[model samples]
Target: MAAILTSLRNTVIAGFVLSLVLILMFLNWGGTLDYNFCAFLVRWLHVISGVMWIGLLWYFNFVQIPNMPSIPDDQKPAVSKVIAPAALFWFRWGAMSTIVFGIILAWQNGYLLDAYTLGAAEGFSVHKNIAIGIGMWLGTIMWFNVWFVIWPNQKIALGIVDAPADAKPKAGRTAMLFSRVNTMLSVPMLFAMVSAQNIY
Candidate 1:
């Protein structure tokens, strides 16, 4: 019992199982779960994952990369070997999850195409549609970079999985440059998303 509780994976799995049981109990007790509840859940998932993704992006740009030059050569591997790989794991998955949940939320509300097309009716308002469209586009680009460019490069750079030794430096620089590009776009992407709720 104590051993199970002490394991990080076991603890997380137990918590999830407990939460699932509670949700099932609520459903059995005639607590109606509606479309709104599902939408809320999807939105919550989006927000949580977005925070994790962007938080690590900031950490990389604002904290780790900026401080790298100052660290001694002997200490640098600790950051590259240990901290980076862990952070990258969360960062890439968070980006993927955020996009997935955002799509699910939009699809559930029957606005996935409408939002993508910037509101596709004569009576529709353009403000919210445009805002959400920009966010969606930006998120899509960021997701592409995460999976295709950044993650592949980072795997090489950190030696998580290897490539030619000569590839490491180039891969690392490419990942950092793309990350910086994403960081610059994130500000407007967030603005567009938040503004979509009210600006219309």
Candidate 2:
């Protein structure tokens, strides 16, 4: 247990092993392999990816960005050149995985079009679909910002890509603003998603 806990890869593998044991137990107890079970698994994956993406997003806003100014200028490179890049890699991929799994979950549950259309297929009468649709749209917009806007500007800002020195500040500002935008949207997005599952 100590060895596994000391290594992230091993810890994650152990977690999956535990999940597999749970599934085997369920099957042994007479749970059937079915479409609903498959859909549940997709949703579980979506949630995991979302936690990674949004958790990192919040970490940047709530911790790193705010604390950066206090750090000595000389030591700043440790964060910029090392930590930031590693975190961003996981952040962007987490966003990608979240969106992909979310879309797949929606499709598996047979609400892809209805949710995307905000229940227009049902004349917007289904509150559940409408709620999820709003969350989905918000998530999509956030994902787009992460990939197309934030990542590109961040690359320039972080000096991963070459740009005139003057442009770096501007690029950094742009990325920060969009990241803030996503943070602002995150609360309502989570509300809408949970509402779809529980309230609506």
Best by lDDT: 2
- Predictions in order: lDDT: 0.88, 0.96
Residue range 1-200, candidate 1, lDDT tens digits: 78779998998789778878988897899877798878877897899889999999899999999999999999999999899999999999999999999999889987788777767663556678768888888988988988999999999999888689999999999999999988988998898899887675
Q: Could you give candidate 2's per-residue lDDT for residues 103-161 as a string of tens digits?
A: 99999888889999999989999999999999999999999999999999999999999
> Which prediction has the highest TM-score against the true structure?
2
What is the total number of backbone clashes in candidate 2? 0
Alpha-carbon runs more than 4 Å astray in model 2:
none
TM-score of each: 0.83, 0.97
